[model samples]
Target: MGADDKTQNNAEKLGGKVQEGLGKATGNKDMEAEGQKDQSKADLKNAGENIKDAFKGK
Candidate 1:
């Protein structure tokens, strides 16, 4: 993946982790779920980028 995309994904994943931790500490199930969703989205985007890069032989 490009540098910007990778950076954005990493930032999103980190943010999600923080959110998840905060939610768990505060006992907020909805916030925890949202964090999990954010992480999943970041992971999926990374995976897609990897696939594209592979196809391009990069």
Candidate 2:
């Protein structure tokens, strides 16, 4: 994946982690679920980029 894409994905994952932590600490199930969703989305995007790179023989 490109540097920018990787960085962005990492940031998203980190943000999600923070959100999840805060949600758990405050007992907010919705925020925790949202954070998990964000992390999942970032992971899916990163996986897509990896697949594209593989197809391109990078």
- Winner by TM-score: 1
lDDT of each: 0.89, 0.90
Candidate 1 lDDT, tens digit per residue, 1-58? 3768978998899899999999999999999999999999999988988888889888
Candidate 2 Cα outliers beyond 4 Å, as residue runs:
none
How would you encode candidate 2's per-residue C-alpha lDDT over 1-58 as one tens digit per residue?
3768978998999999999999999999999999999899899989988888888888
Question: Which residues of candidate 1, in runs, are more than 4 Å off?
Answer: none
How far does residue 43 in candidate 2 sit from its true spot (Å)?
A: 0.4
In the order shown, the candidates' Cα RMSDs to the true structure are 1.1, 1.2
